[model samples]
Target: MTRTEELFLALRQQIVEGKIPHGHKISEPELANQFQVSRSTLRDALARLKSIGLLVSQPNVGYSVISLSTEHLMEIFYVREALEGMACRLAASNITQEQLQNLRDLLESHESSVQLKSGVAYIQEERDLDFHFVIVQASHNPMLIDLLCEKLYFLVRMYRYQFGMVSDRAKRAFFEHQHIVHALSVGDGELAEFLMRRHISASRDNVERNLLVNKGVIS
Candidate 1:
């Protein structure tokens, strides 16, 4: 990968995992030094992250981690529902046997990871993404895939932070994933779409519950 891409991934990882905390200001020079890249390369990386809404750049105050407000979370969910719902519909029509098998393999891997009680956040996160990305690619729509990629990075960050807030969320999510995959495997496009929409909508509900609990607005 390019130096700029490498820098962007590193910084994005840190921010998403909460290593860099919300509202924390990112030091350009420090980041440049840490990544062993020149300031210009770092700036390019920062700009990419900014475009994804992970970081906010100011005129003189530099860049800070973007804070997620309730409104922003709702917006993210709205876009995700539309984009991912469409992806599922397209994938149902276009998905080949090979792609379906690949998804099964990913699901098996995720199940094993969960059973083993692995605490590697990145691994879990990637496995979850692999499941969705396969469907997005199967859609055979370059425009849709591009848009999903842009939105995914930000969603990953937020989801990872809220990961632990819901009880057995991952376990439930795995089952929901299996339901969607089953529908796809049977060539049931409408069933697949319904399951996919419910999966995302349920996640939105869980996240809202998490936020309410965090704010002590819900018992």
Candidate 2:
């Protein structure tokens, strides 16, 4: 990767992992010096982060990391329910034999990971094999890929990392993934869409329940 691209990814990881805490103001000159990059290069990276909604720059205020909000997280889940559902439906039709095998392999590996973690939610290790991400790519729809994978996925990971979000339904989620994959393998677009939507809905419900009961985020 080029210097600017490298800087962009580095800053993005730090921000998403909360190394640079949410709502922390960024000083361009200081950040540039810290990273040993030029001001222009740093600005390029910051602008890319801003494009993804991770950072916001005001007229006089410069840039600050976006604060985590339960409401926004729920909003994203709703969008994922719709878009990823459609992607799953399209994937049932457009997916290649190789893609199908890749998905099956991914599930096997994910299953092993889940078992190793004692039913804990498996984190995406191979970026390409992130189950949902791979399914979306299988749709062969550039718009859907860009919206979900490029735009929203990182934000979801950010929330998970920052909140230490771990679902009690990890094993159940793995089963749901299996069902969705089966529907895709059989080229059942309707079933695939329904299963995908239901999976995302369940996840959103879990997050809402935890926010209310555990975090008391909702009154």
Most lDDT-accurate candidate: 2
Worst 10 residues of 1 by lDDT: 115-124
The sequence of per-residue lDDT tens digits that candidate 1 reaches over residues 70-184 is 7677777788787887888888888989898888988887777744254322234552356777788887888888777665655555555644433436677778889988888
TM-score of each: 0.83, 0.94
Which digits, one per residue and each the tens of the lDDT, describe model 2 over residues 1-219?
889999999999999899998889999988999999999999999998998888989999999998888898899899999999999999999999999999999988877774436865656653587899999999999999988888787887788787674668788888899999999999999999999999999999988888888775432
Clashes of each: 0, 0
Instruction: State the TM-score for model 1.
Output: 0.83
The parts of candidate 2 lying over 4 Å away from their true place are 114-117, 216-219
Maximum-TM-score candidate: 2
**lDDT of all the models against the reference?**
0.75, 0.88
- Pairs that collide in candidate 2 are none
At residue 160, give the lDDT of candidate 2: 78
